[model samples]
Target: MSRRPGRVRRAASAALLSLLLVAGCDTGGAEDAGGGQPAASGAAEVPGEIVLASGRDVTGRGGIRQQLITEWNRQQEAKGVAYRARLVELPGSADQQRSQLLGALQSGSAEYDVVNLDVTWVPEFAAAGLVQPLPDRLVDEDVIKSVAETARWGGKLYAAPFNSDVGLLFYRRDYLTSAGVTRPDLGKDAGWPVVQQLIGVLDAARNRLPAAYAKGWTSQLDASYEGLTVNGVEAFASAADGFSLTDKEGRYAGSVAELQAGLDELRNRTQAAYTLPDAVHSDEADTLTDFAAGRTAFLRHWPYAYRTLHQSLSAEQLGVAPLPGKAVLGGQNLAVARGSQRTAAALQLVAFLTGKESERCLLDAGFAATRVSAYEDGALTCTTAKPAGQAAASPTGERTDRMPRDGNGRPAYARGTLLPALENAVQRPRTPLYGAFSQTFAGQLARLQGGTPPSDAQLAADLDRQLKRALPSH
Candidate 1:
């Protein structure tokens, strides 16, 4: 707490950050509306078209999602069920899509049967009764345990996880080799200290650094949105023994001391010496762009970046491992709209989309799978065929799907790296007022990016005060 100790701590932190700056960088990707009929309670719902609404698929147009829907429709036709599912990709960013869904459901303007809700939005939508409670079987033992927790609010299942995500550490093996690193594969046990040491070696070999390499690492740290809050939570969770900003009831439960610890960890991680200068303002897209450009050696990004980054960098150049420290959990969940008349058929569609096969399909296409089988079970292959014209034949006459996969058809790192990361990932605060919580959390943390940032104790006190205002306190 003394000025001399503070200066020494700052110097030591800078030295540690210096180690990472020389070593790494960070990287890395909606839906539809309407078409439902109203039915009175106890009356047989019509076997009509089921409209599945969601944000744009990051896998490109006619992606795996559409392929699965096409497959479902084929099955329905063969069975003469008369219930076909159509995907309605909602226009706009996640925030805009959330607003659209809320307005549409509240006004009954869009009769969407199934809605894709972000993991964080599940609580809000369920709390407002916009989405109906789903059967427990919809989220069974096969689902990833951490992901399954996101489907419930108020002690009942309201949404089924369609896909799940967690942060992962991506590094350039070529860069490390160029810098003369002997063990370029930072393996499962690689922690922040290990990364810092690696960066120091990279710094020592500056003459051999990649041409575009300007920083050790980069991440989504934009304070205007959820990125900063996510990074903050990860650091907080890593630093605090059992960090939880809000309780199960969404009430403020964190303490000033905990906030101080988290703040300090975040500061150390993002010190200007080791982080990309622009990282303070970078979102996911920006960070991915920078990382892909070879601006940084290491990147902290979501699961999809594995496929996206692979498109530009070869397997020899790209390597991914579990992110050092904690990672925040992300992804969307599927829920039936409360006003849907085709509830039963819609539920069937939901089940099929979130089934073991469908989850495998999602995993193969780059999204994180919600089921353990998608990562671990070799027998569970993605049964859905690629839509016509979606896949092209390579020179070798084999189907060319760009995503790298193992013999089991899972993402190359699915079982060993991604699965454990998802299982251990921390959730963002779950609250009806999550919008307010995130905004406040991000806005307060932005101060840390300023030239004259507040001390950890000061920032912690301010954050603790603001969060208490944004969420209820016990």
Candidate 2:
């Protein structure tokens, strides 16, 4: 969820204040001093070492990142390029990750040759000159065109897409059948009203449905980072009306009235049925847990949740659909550190990891792939446990069934649902002050969730003030 950026510093005082307040508390530990120099330049070339600063642990078996890295190692070894990746796990919070990466770059002591960055962080990294811009020849124009646009700043590529993610709608087919309601048509233009009505129908028949299917719908309405960023910002941005908080000119778009209306709609709709009232305070783990436990009839979540949900319920009981509004796109990008001396080798490693073969491996291991070809590859429908092996076929094993389909019957996974959303959906204002913006939004959302019901005018005024202060003119 990181990308490149614009805007310049206003004053020394503001810069110092940001450093003291935001950056000081979150910078991670210094680089490892024990690690010796990077592998020699020509020592069997592929055998060279590359430190990978990962936001998550790569040692975990069956994880997409781990699988991709493992394959890369095998390929490198086979080609006589003995490549070794040492992963330094960083804090998982986006804010913390950005702070740590920025601090490391500024310190010039980070030895990592490859850095896994959130899609949104690309802009900040490029602006700070922390990562190297990808060379034209290394990028696959067709594949990169689809995935690399997010990593660009002023029209230059800064990173390569790693693992792609997007929001998907999940419903209970059994409950829908019991209610005698036909499956809702989830076409490209599906709107909130349609979703609301479907939930309404489910609510009216709650008494007849199983206790676990009583709740009409659920989402991550919590004030946590993920909730705020995804459900609040991403979902709101994709609303038919666009983000109520930001205008087309990248200015404050909504009055307090608009924001309250949006919040009220979200809250009242969920509250009408037996939903988790504290969802506004829950995290991704909690949201996923509730869905897995069958506490709700419908949920909107990332693709990884599909694997976990499949283990808990029969595919027949589960129905996948694209979100009603613009879906939020989330994923990781791989970049070479500007200071690294192994740009060529690192780029080669990145290409191998993001290639069609690696993507196939990722999808087979229960992770989503970024490439369109991977999705179309018949192997995805084949049910196999091996990273790159053919999947074992079952009645429910079809990719068409596993992935959400639009009204037109097209797969509504990352490409169908989120690609358009990225092109037209609301993006967080591309300001260096996003940290402040997110914090303010979270604080205000907490109050609304607590039933404070502040005036829309007041809310808008306060938000405008904060934004202006956060990004004052130089």
Candidate 3:
């Protein structure tokens, strides 16, 4: 799947199709290098090319991640260093990519010096000694507090927070105005009650609404994977004060009463009257399409959707705010492989890629930045990627920038809404057995979405029992 010249690839709202994993074939014309192996004990370190294996960049072809790497390579060349970095995007879903990385690292099959790992995978990889601990300075005060917590295991730094993500509420401002509402800004303080009330107004004005309008809101609630787990976690956290299902050691610490409370919130939010019926079967792609087609007034989505949606929706038609309650923290972290022979250069690459200027570049390209300065410091701008004011050029040579921006060229919502959301976001369970935990948790929550859902108490007891078995118990 080589990219055509001069063609600008926009983010597609479809599931990632399976593709053959080609090493160094279309990576900016880099040569194919053999897999890296562990050097013998006390072996002299050498400067050479380091491979960074990651999942596909959602930012489209030659995305910001690649541009950052290319910039790093250029710096090394100017300094007369022999080290260069190559990015290898593994082909498949996140789960498949995790498995592939695990196999490649454990069996020494791939010569990866660094890996872009999901936040949840930090504990597992660190515990397994698959990745090396990084310097504390790499994650400092400038990094978002809640986000920086994802890079550590047992109080040691295992990875560096790259770009980050949090759930946000995207609403159709036109729909609100159509409902005769004066103020459409559902500010940072807007809660679930406000959302439900606004939904009632939209419902009352359905006669004047678009034909596609059918429900108040939509979200990715598909029961097959992480969608259900994330939405469930948000519900649980919102229901109970300081709710945490597991302890720091990743053991089952939740009681039946707590589970019951969480289940009640989940049920209330997904009631048939408020949520789109298709949400039960919807993933990220489905929910995005439904919102864009005017089927719903409100949407729960990630930051990248801000750019994707703006491509089709004007600023006057769209408005974004913080999620009603808690948002599940998400994004990848950069970790050095334990077997890498270029550990020194690998660390340098990680530092450069996650630095302040680079993070600004990521935010400008539609990724949620991990640093606060990228949002608040209007003086700082992305110097590595495209120029701030340059319009996006399409394959047809048409140039336009539809996404709205602030005075600093950051996304319009970055400082006021997005940064605060990241500061207060909650993480999924951090444990060596997160894989097992997600499967067990999502499987039990699916009962709430069934035709005849079980009572909250019944589901709570069932979830508690299953979670106790899936993870270690106190």
Which of 2 and 3 is the better model by TM-score?
3
Measured against the true structure, the TM-scores of the candidates, in listed sequence, are: 0.89, 0.75, 0.91
Top TM-score prediction, candidate number? 3
Q: So what's the TM-score on candidate 3? A: 0.91
lDDT, candidate 2, 372-395, per-residue tens: 555554433311113222222325
lDDT digits (tens) for residues 1-474 of candidate 3: 132221121123352211111111012212111112323334566777889999888677778888788877876776677789999999977889999999999999899999999999999999999999888998889999999999999989999999899999999999999999999889788998899999999999999899889999999887776888999999999998788988888888899999999999988888888999878777776778778878899999999888778767899999999999999999999999999988877888888888888888888888899998889887887766666645576667654446788877888888888899999999998889999999999999998877898999999999999999999999
RMSD of each: 8.5, 11.4, 6.5
Deviation in Å, model 1, residue 234 alpha carbon = 0.4
Compare candidates 2 and 3 on lDDT and give the better one: 3
lDDT of each: 0.81, 0.57, 0.84
Q: Where is model 1 more than 4 Å wrong at Cα? A: 1-41, 386-402
For candidate 1, which ten residues in a row score worst on lDDT? 23-32
Candidate 1, after superposition: displacement of residue 292 in Å?
Answer: 1.0
